[model samples]
Target: MTFLSGWGRTAPTPATLVAPRTAPELSALIAGASSRGLIARGLGRAYGDAAQNAGGVVVDVAGMEARWSLDPDTGVVTATAGMSLHDLMLALVPRGWFVPVTPGTRHVTLGGAVAADVHGKNHHVDSSFGAHLRSLTLVTADGTSRVLGPGDELFWATVGGMGLTGLITEVSFACVPVETSRVRVDVERTRDLDHTLEVMTATDDRYRYTVAWIDLLARGSRMGRSVLTRGDHARRDELPAGADPLAFAPSSRLPAPPWAPNGLLNGLTVRAFNEAWYAKSRERRVIQDLAPFFHPLDFVDGWNRVYGSRGFVQYQFVVPFGEEGTLRRVVSRLSAEGVVSFLTVLKRFGPGTPGMLSFPMPGWTLALDIPAGQTGLAGLLREFDEWVAGAGGRLYLAKDARMRAELLPVMYPRLAEWRKIRESVDPGEVFRSDLARRLSL
Candidate 1:
C-alpha cells in the first residue's frame, strides 16, 4: 500500500495502487478486487479525493494501451483513456488539430476528462468534454466491456460519474481543426463584477473563448474586479512572417520550490499577486501561443507547491442565469471575509451536456483556490455551500474535497436517477471512491 493525495495535497490516504498495462489486466484486477473496492486514477489533477479510496484499491490507468490514431479526413481519433491531453496536444496540434475541449491544465487523462466532464473558457460555446465524445468502451463492475454512445443511459451516467459507474478503457472523440497554435487574444480589466458580466453577456458571442480572473480579496467598489481575456484560434494569415503556424512546443520556465511554509499564500501576498496580474495585462489584442493563453500555469510545473504542504481547497460552484444577485452576494461575502483566493476565476456557462451530474449549466460559475490551512476555512465554505444551495447552485464534484453530503441531492436534482442507472450496471457497487462514500453517491 502507498499513500496518495489529490493535487490539493489534502487528505492523504493509503491505498493499494496497481497500474495495469492492458485492458485484460485491468478487467481481471477489477473482477478480483478485495472488499475495499476500487477506483480509477489518472493524472491526479483533481483537487479533491475523487481518485483516492481509503484502504481500497486504485488502478492507475496511465499504463493502459494509450496509443492513439487520428483520421485527418474526419477529424476523429481513438485512444485508450490513459492518454494525457498534454501528449494529445503535442501530437495533434502539430498536425493542425486541437482537442475539442481542454481545462486550464493539459496534464489530465482522457478518462479523467470524461469522468469529470470538464469545461473550459469556451464552455459558453462548446459545452463540456462529454459533449464531444463520439463513443467509449466502459468496463462495468461485472468486468464486461461494452462500447457505448450517446443513446445509452449507461454512457451518460459514466460521463461525469466520477468513475463510479465503471472504468473507461477506450475513448474515441472528434478533434477540432485549427489553422495555427497562436490565439488572437483580447484582454481588458473590469471595474467590478457587474461590469464584467455585462460585457461578457453583451459581446461574448464575438469570441470562442472567454474567462475572467477575479480578485477575490479586493473590497469596496473593486470587490469583484477582474481581468477578462477573450480570444479564438488565430488563422495562419494572422501570424508574423516566417513564423511556424503549426509549431507546438511548450516549455516549463521553472518548477515551484520543493517546499514552502504553510500559509505562504495569505491575504497580503495573494493581493499583491492579483494586483500585478491585473496590471500586467494593460495591453489589449495580444497574440500568444495556445499554451500561454490557455494553460499559463502549465509553464510552471508543480506550481501547486507554492500553496505550501498543507495544500489548498478549490471551491467551484455555479448558479444558473437570473441569479446574478446570488453571485454578487457570494463575491461580497468572500471579499468581506478577506479570503485569499489567488486564482479565482469567473466564467459564463452555456448549455450543459447529458452527463447527469455534470457541473456546468447555463449560468455563472466561480472557482476559488483558497489555502486550506487558513483558520475557519471549512466553516466559511460550509456557510457558502448553504447559500449556494439555497440559490439553486451546485458545486463541482471533480474539485470538491470537503463539501457536506446532504447538498448532493440538493445541488444535483438528478442524483436519484443517476444512482438508479448506476445501480443497474453496478449492482454490487464494486466501483467506489472516497468521494462516492463521502457524498453517499
Candidate 2:
C-alpha cells in the first residue's frame, strides 16, 4: 500500500494511491474498488485528515490537467476539478475576470476548494465557495457520473461535505471581473480589544475584502490589539504611471529551511516576532499586488514547515451576529491565558450556502494557527467548541483536525439532512475519509 497524507503532513497513513489521468480511468478505478472504500484527493492542501483514508483506495485527481473555457456572454467558466486557483487566476486576471471567492492560499485545487467550501477575506461580502458554484459533475460510488446543480440536494451535501458524497470531476462557476491584479488597500492599527472591534464594525463594508491580524502575545490592557487591512480590486488608473498595464508580477518568495528546529517558534520568539510585526505596520493606504494581499503566507514556499515536524492546527470558529459578546469573551480568555498563537485573524461573515456542513453564517469569525505541539492544545480547542456551540457557531471542517463527533451535529444544524443525502447516494459508505470517520459525517 502507498502512504499519503494531507498538506499538514500529520497522521500519515498507508493506502493504495491511484493517479488516474482521465475521468474515465477514475470512474473505472472506483467501479473496480467495491471492497475497499475510496476517497478523492486533490492538491492535498487540506490541513488535516480530510483528504486521507487509511487502508483504502485513494484517487489523486491532480494529474487530470484539463484546461478551462469561459462563456464570454455570462462570464461563466467550466473547468476540470484538478485545476488550481493559481492557474485560473493567471488565465483570467488578464481578461478582467477573477474568482468569485479565494481562500488564503491559491495552491488549492478546484475540487479541494469546493469540497471544503472555502471562504476568504471577502466572505462577509460574498459567502463561501459553494455560494458561487453553478454546477458540478460528481462520480458516485456506483461509477455513474451525474451533474448536480443548485436545485439538487446532492449538490448541497457535496459542497463542504469533505468528499464523502462523491468524487467531483468537473466544476462550472461564474467569475468576478476586475480591472487589474493590483489592490488598493487601507491599513489601520488598533490599540486594544475595544478599538479593534470598533474599527471593524465601523468601516468593514467600505472595502470588498477585510481582515485583522491580532497580536496574540499582548496581555492586560493591550490584549487583542490588531492591525486591520481592507482593500478592493484596483482600477487601471490606480496604478503608478510607469507600471505595466498588462503584466502584473507577484513578489518573489523565500523558501523555509527544511531543517529548522522544533523550538524555533516558542513563546519568546513568537512574542518578539509579533512585536516587530505590529511595530512595522503603522503605515496606512499601501498599494499591493493581489497575490500578497490575498495570500501573504503563500509567498514563503513550504512555510507550513515553520511549525516543525509536528505540523499545526488551524482553529477557526464563527459566532452569530448578535453574539459578538461571546466572541469577545473567547478572545479575551485566549489573551489572558496566553495561548501563543502566531497567527490570529478576525472577520465578519454574511450568510452561508445550503451545504449541510457549510461553515459560514451571519457572524464574526476568528481563525488562529497554533502549533500542534503546544501543551493542552487539543483540550483547549475542545473547550472552545462548547463556547462556540453555545453561541450558535460552528468550526470550519476544512481546517479541523480534532473536533468531537457529538458536537458536529450541534454546530451544523443541517447534519441530518446531509447524512440523508449522503447515505442515499453512497448507501454502503464506499466513499469515505479519515475526517468523515472522525466526525461521524
Candidate 3:
C-alpha cells in the first residue's frame, strides 16, 4: 500500500496506487475498482484531499504518455491529460502563445487544471481555465470514454466537479497569443486595506493580470497594507532593442531543506519578513520575465516544507462584489489575532464558467497559508467559514482541507445540481476521494 496526501502533506492515507499508460488501461482499472472506490491523481498540487482515496485506488496519471499538437492558426492546443502546464508552456511560449489562464504554478497537470477550473491573476480579464476549454474526454465508471464540450451538461459537471463524475483523459483549449514572453508590470504600495482596494478597483482594468500581496501580520492603521502588482504581456515595441521577445526559459529552482522545525515560520520570523518585504517594495514600473511575474513561488522547490513537519492549511475564500465588509472583517480578525500566514494574496475575479462547482465568481478572493498546528486555528477558520458563507462567499475546494460539510451546500448553491449530474454519471459512486467522503460531495 502507498500512503498519499495532497500538496499540503497532511492527513496521508494508505491506498493502492496504479499508473496506466493509455485510456484503455485506465478504463479497465476503473471498471474493476473495489467498493472502496477510485480517484485520479496528477502532480498532487491540490493542497488538500481532492486527489486522495484512503484504502481505495489512486490512479497516478502523471507518467502517462503525453501526446499534444498545436494549431498555430487558431492558437488552440490538444493534449493528453497527463501533460503539465510547465511542459505546455515550454512548447507554446516559443511559438508566441500562452495558456489562457494559469494558476500560481505550472507543475499542475492539464487534467488537474480542468478539474479544478483554476484561475490566476488574469481572472479579472480571462476568467478561469474552464472558460477557455473547448472540449475534453472523460472515462466514466462504466468504462465508457466520451468527448464533452461546452454544450454538454456533463462537461460543466466535470469541469470543476473535483473529478467525482469521471476520469479526464484529454483536453483541448485555446491559447492566448503573446508578442513576448516578458511582462510590463506596474507596482503600488498601499497604506492600508481601503487604499489597496480603491487602487485595485480603479486601475485593475488596465492590466490583464493583477495581484496584491498582503501583510496579514500588520495591525492597527497599518493592517492590510499590501503591494499590488499589475501587468500584461509586453508588446514587441516595449522590449529593449535586440532582446528575445519570445524567450521562454524559466529560472532554475532552489530546493528547500528536506525538513524544517515545527516553528520554522513562526509569527516573529514571518513578521520580520513581512516588514522587510513591505519596506523594500516601492511604487515602480518595470519589465520582468513571465516566470517571476506569474509563478514566483515555483522557483522554490518544496517550498511548503518551510512550514514545518506539521504541515499547513491554505485558506482561500472569495466573497461576491459589494461584500468588501466581509473581506475587511476577515482581514481584521486575522490581524488582531496575530495569526502567522506565511503568504497572503488578494485577487479580483470576473465572470465564471458554467461549472456548477467552480470556485470563482465576480468577487474578491483572499488566499493565505497558516501552520496547521497553530493554537485555536481550527476554531478560528471555522468562524471565518461562517462569516464567508454568511456573505455568500465560498472557499476554494482545491485548497480546502478542514472546512465543515454543512457549509458546502450553503456556500455552493448549485451543490444539488452538481450532485445530481455526478450521480447520473457515477451512480455506483465508483469515483471517490478523501475529500468526497469528508464533505459528502
- Top candidate on TM-score is 3
Residue-by-residue lDDT tens digits, candidate 1, 93-187? 99999999999999999999999999999999999999999999999999889999999999999899999999998899999999999999999
lDDT per residue as tens, model 3, 337-389: 99999999999999999999999999999999998798998999999999999
Better of 2 and 3 by lDDT: 3
Candidate 3 regions with alpha-carbon error over 4 angstroms: none
> Against the true structure, what is each candidate's TM-score?
0.98, 0.97, 0.99
Q: Per model, how many backbone clashes are there? A: 0, 0, 0
1 or 3, greater by lDDT: 3
Q: Rank the candidates by TM-score, best first.
A: 3, 1, 2
lDDT of each: 0.91, 0.87, 0.94
Question: Could you tell me which residue pairs clash in candidate 3?
Answer: none
Local lDDT at 272 for model 2: 95
C-alpha RMSD of each candidate structure in angstroms: 1.0, 1.4, 0.8
